[model samples]
Target: MTLPRMKLTDPKALRGYAHPLRMALLGLLRQQGPMTATRAAEQLGESVASCSFHLRQLAKYGLAERAPGADARERPWRATARATSWDDDSDDPQVRAATDELNAAQLALYTRQAEEFLARRIDEPTEWRAVTGFSDQSLYVTAEELAELTGRIDALLAEYDDRITDPSRRPDGFRRVSLIQLAVLSASPGGGPAPAASANPVEATPAAEPDAAR
Candidate 1:
C-alpha cells in the first residue's frame, strides 16, 4: 500500500515537531509499525516515561496516532504518515523560521547516523563495506530539471515502500539502508571565483521523498 503522508503548514505544529527525540520516535514508528512507549524506549535507549511523553506530543501535532492495542490497558502508537513534509517556501516568517529549526535538527540526525556507520564500517563484512558509504557530485541543471529529477527518484524508491511494513517481503540478508540526497545550488549566476577542487569527490543520489522531513 502507498503510505500516507503528512504535510505540516501550521507554525505551531512545525515547531513542536522540530525536536530530536520526537523525530527519532516518528522514524521508529514508521520503520517498526505500531509500538508501545516501553517497546519504543527499549529500541531507542530512552526512558519509558520520556518516550511516552514525546509520543503523546507527536499525536498532538497530527504526526502520530493511537493504534489498536493488545488489550484495553495497552496503548500502541504509530506514525500517522510514513513521510512528513512542509512548505519551505511559505510566505509566513514564523513558518519559515520553524522549518529552518526543523531542518537543522534533521541534518544533525543524519550526520550522527553517518558518523556511527563510519565508526564501525571497518568491521563490516567485505560485501557490506563495498556497498555502503556515501558519494557526492556537482550537477548543473535548471530548477525545473532538478524538480523532475527528484520526482523520478522518489518514484523509484516507492517500488520498495511495501517492504517497510511487511517483514515477509524482505529477502534474506536484507537490512535497512539510509539514503540522504542533497541537491543545492553551489553558486549563483556570475558569482565568485571557482573554489578549489577536492582530492577525492563522490557521486550523488537523489532521496526517496520530496520535501520530506523524516
Candidate 2:
C-alpha cells in the first residue's frame, strides 16, 4: 500500500496535535501498525487510560482512526496517515506557536532515540555497529537544488516505507532504523539567510585561505 501522508493546514488541527504524548502515540501507530490502547500503553510505559484518551484526541484531529477489525471493547487504532506535514510559512500566530511546540516535541524524541541507540550500540552486531553513527555534513547550493536534494532523499526513503506498516516485509536480522533527515539552510557570516550562488560562483565569495580550510 502507498504511504498515506496528510498535509495539515488547519491551525485548529495543529493545536490539537501539540501534546507530546499524542505525538508519541501517533508516531507509534504510524511506525508500527494497528494497536489497542492497552498494548500501546504497555509499550510506551504509560497508563492505558492516558493512551486511550490521546488516541481519541488524535482521531478528533483526523490523525488516527479505528482499525477495520476494531469494536467497542476491543478497539484498535491506527494512524490515518504515515506522516503529518506542516509548512513553516504559515502566517497565523496560533499555527506558528503550535508548530514550534510540535517541533520541540519532535526534537526531544529524536534526541532520546539517538541516546538510546548509542547506549546499546556496543552490543549490536558488528555489521550494524560499522554502519551506525552520526553523519553530519554541509553543502553550498541554490534553493532549488536543495529542494531537489530533499525530494531525492525522500524518494530513496520511500523504498523502505512499506516495512514500517508491514511486519512481513521485514527481513531476517533486520530491525527498524530511525533516519532523521534535516536539510537546513546555513546562515551567512552576517547571520541572515545565505544568498543564492551567483552565475560567476568564483567571484561571489573570496577563496578560503589554506589555514581557514579546516
Candidate 3:
C-alpha cells in the first residue's frame, strides 16, 4: 500500500478536525490503518451515523480521505497527513477560530493522554522505567514570528520521529512528551493566543490513548 501524503489545506483542513471525535477518527486511521466509519464508530464508542458524519467532515478538510476505489458505501478511509501543526499566522477571524478550536482540542487530547501514561506506569511493575521532560516559558512575538518558530520546532521534532524505531538508537522503556505551551505569556497572561511565547519540547508524539491495555 502507498503511504498517504499530507493533504492539509490552508484553513479548511483546520476546521475539519477541530472536534474531539474527529481527531479521534483520524487517529483510528493512522494507528490502525484504513477503516470504515462503522469500525471507527465501534472503536470510538460512537454510533455509525455519527462516525460517518465525522468521516465526511474529515474528507472536507482533505485530512483523511476515502480509499481510492471506495464507493458511496462505508469504505476504508486513510489519513492524508501523518501529523499537523500550526500557529496563529493569519488574521482572518473564521480561520483563526477554526485553528484555535482545533489547537485547543488537540492539546487537550495530548494532555489527557500524557496523564494516563503516567498513571498506567505508576500502577504497573514493568521493566520499562518512567521518565519525564517538560518546559514552560514566556516569549514576546507576533503571529508571523510564532509561525516561523513553530516551523523550526516541527522540523527539529521530526528529526527524532524514527529514532526510537532504529535499532541503532537502543531501545528503552523511556518516553517523552514535548508540549509547546505558546500563548500570551505577558499581557494576556492567561495564555492569550497562539502567537505568544511558545516553548517547544523535542520529544512529543501524537497523543496516545489512555487505555493502551485495550
Candidate 4:
C-alpha cells in the first residue's frame, strides 16, 4: 500500500538477490500477478522445478511470499515489492561489494534484453519501430540538482504505478516498458574518453543471456 519498494541494506540480502532468475522472477510477479511456479516456467520457457526453487529462495530473502490462495498442489508466489532500492555508496566494504555484484548482474540482464529487442526490431510494426530507439543526452548539474531530477523522475513514474500494479487498468495497445535511468558524476574535462560525434558512436558488445534458463 505504501508504493512497495524494498529498501535493501544488508549484504546478505543483496547477495541473495543478485541471481538472474531471482531478479527476473521478481519482475515477472510484479508485472503480472500471483503465479504458480508452473505458470512462471511456462512464460519463461524454463523448468517448473527451477522456478519453484528460486521462488523459495526469494521468499527466504523476503523478496517474495506465498500468495493468499495458494494450496499444496499449486502454490502461488508474489513479489513483496514492486521495485528494489539500494544505495550504491555504502560505508561497509562488504555492502559495496554486494551492491556491485547486483548492479553488474542487472546491467548484464538489461543489455541482453536490449540486444534481443534489436535483433527483432526490424520486423516490429512500423509504428513501434518509429517510436523506439536509443537516445543520448548530456547535462551539467550539481549534486543537489541531480538528486532533485531523480526525485522528479520518480514522481513521474509514480503517476503510472497504478497502471502497473493493476493489470486491468492497462490500455488496449500498451505493453510493458522498461525505463532505465543511469546518472554518473562527471570528472574534469579530459578525465575520461571524449564525447563521440553524432555520425559514429561506439557500440557495446552484445550480452549473452544468463545461464539461469538452463
Candidate 5:
C-alpha cells in the first residue's frame, strides 16, 4: 500500500508543527489510529483540554482531521498522513528557520527516548537489551555519496512500512521500534585541528544525569 504523507512547504504550518506535544500527539494517532482527546490524553499523560486545543491546531495546518466516531457527540482525531516531510534545502529564510525549530524538537524527542530506554533497559528482555544501544560511526564520503547512503537506508526501512498500519501483517513477537538516523559533516569546512590540541586527545567526559526524571 502507498502510505499517505503530508509535505509541509508553508512556514506557518512548519512553525505550528514544531511543538513537542503536538508532534507526540501526531505520532500517537499514526501508530494507534483514531482517538478522542480524552483517550489521547490518557495515552500521552496530558490534559484532555490541552489535547483538544492541540488537535484543533493540527487540523488548522492540515496535519490532522476529525474521524468518524461511534456517535454524533463523540468526535475523534486522526492523522491526515502516515508520514510528514519538509524541504530541508529550502532557500526561503522563514522555511529554513521553521525547519530548524522542527528538527530541534524532533532531536529532543529522540534523545529523551534513548535516555529513557537506557534508564529502564535492565528490565527488558535480554534479547532486546542485547540489540538496543547507541553507536556512532565516522564516515568519509562525499555529499552525494552521503545522500545516496541515506536514501538506501530509507528504502530498506520502507520494506516494513506495511506492518505499521496493518497489525495483522506483523509477526507474533513484533514490537514498535524507533530508528533514528543522522548524517552530517563532522567538522567545519576549510578548517583543520586546533593548534593547542595534542597528538593524542582525551575523550570528552559524559554529562551527569539530571536529578529529576522527565
Candidate 6:
C-alpha cells in the first residue's frame, strides 16, 4: 500500500492558530480537559471576559470547538487534535512566512517556559530531577536525509506529549517523562531552549506510594 503524502494547505492551518492567547487557550483546554470559558478563565488567571474572547478566537482557528451542552450560552470547549507538525517550505512565500512565524514564536515560548519551570523546581520540596541529554554522530547525507531525521524526532516527541501526566510515578522519578525535541538550521540564527514542565499538567498520583500505603 502506498502512504499518503502530507503537506500543509494554503493560508496554512497554523496561521490562524499562531496568536499567543489562542495558543494558550488551547493548551488550557487540553490540559484541564473541557470547561466553560468562565472556568477556563479562572484556571488561566485571566478575567472571564478576556478568557471568553480567546475561547471564541480558538474556535475561529479550528484549534478548538464547542462541546455539547444544554444551553448555547453554556457551551464548553475542547482541543481539536492531539498534534500538528510543520516544517520549512520556501516554494510558496505565504507558507514560508507563516511557518517561520509560528516556529519562531513556539521556540521563544518553549525557552521561557522551560527556564521558569527549572528555576522553580529547584525550590520545590518534591523529589524530582531535571535532566538534559544529547546524541551526536556524523552522517554523510543530503538535506532531505537530515530533514527526514527531524521528522522522526518530531513523531517521537509527539508520542510523549500527552503521557507525562502521572504524578504517582513522580517519586520513582521515571514514571513520567517529558520529551522535548529541537532541530535547527545553522545558517539561520536560532532561538533558545525547550518548554519546561508542569506549569499545569494534568493531575496524576506520584509514581511511588507512601510508606503507609505500602
Error of 1 at 57 (Å): 0.8
Stretches > 4 Å off in candidate 2 = 1-3, 68-72, 165-168, 187-214
Best by lDDT: 1
- Model 6: per-residue Cα lDDT over 68-116, one tens digit each: 8768767788766544456576688888888877766665555545565
* Model 4 per-residue lDDT tens digits across residues 81-178: 76787888789999999999988887777776677778987887776666665554577677789889989988987798778557788889984556
TM-score for predicted model 3 compared with the true structure: 0.62
Residue 65 lDDT in candidate 2: 92
* Span of ten consecutive residues with least summed lDDT in model 1: 202-211
Residue 87 miss distance in model 6 (angstroms)? 3.9
Give the winner by TM-score.
Answer: 5
lDDT against the true structure, each candidate: 0.77, 0.69, 0.62, 0.73, 0.75, 0.55
By summed lDDT, which 10 consecutive residues of candidate 4 come out lowest? 205-214
For residue 51, give model 6's deviation from the true position in Å. 2.0
Q: Which ten residues in a row have the lowest lDDT in candidate 5?
A: 205-214
Task: Give the better candidate number (1 or 3) by TM-score.
Answer: 1
Candidate 6: stretches off by over 4 Å: 1-8, 70-73, 124-127, 130-141, 151-177, 188-214
Which residue pairs collide, candidate 3?
184-192
Give the Å error, residue 158, model 3. 2.1
Global local distance difference test of model 1: 0.77
Q: lDDT: which is higher, 1 or 3? A: 1
- Rank candidates, lDDT, best first: 1, 5, 4, 2, 3, 6
Each candidate's TM vs. the true structure? 0.85, 0.78, 0.62, 0.83, 0.86, 0.65
Model 3 weakest 10-residue run by lDDT: 205-214
Clash number for every model?
2, 0, 1, 0, 0, 10
**Which RMSD values do the candidates have, in order?**
3.7, 10.7, 6.7, 5.0, 7.0, 9.6
Off by over 4 Å in 3: 1-12, 68-74, 125-129, 133-153, 162-184, 188-206, 209-214
Q: 1-214, model 1: which lDDT tens digit per residue?
A: 5578888899889989888788888888887788999998998789999999999999999888999999999999988887988878888899999999988887876776677677777887876676766765566678899899999988998898777777799999875677777665666764455555544333222222122364
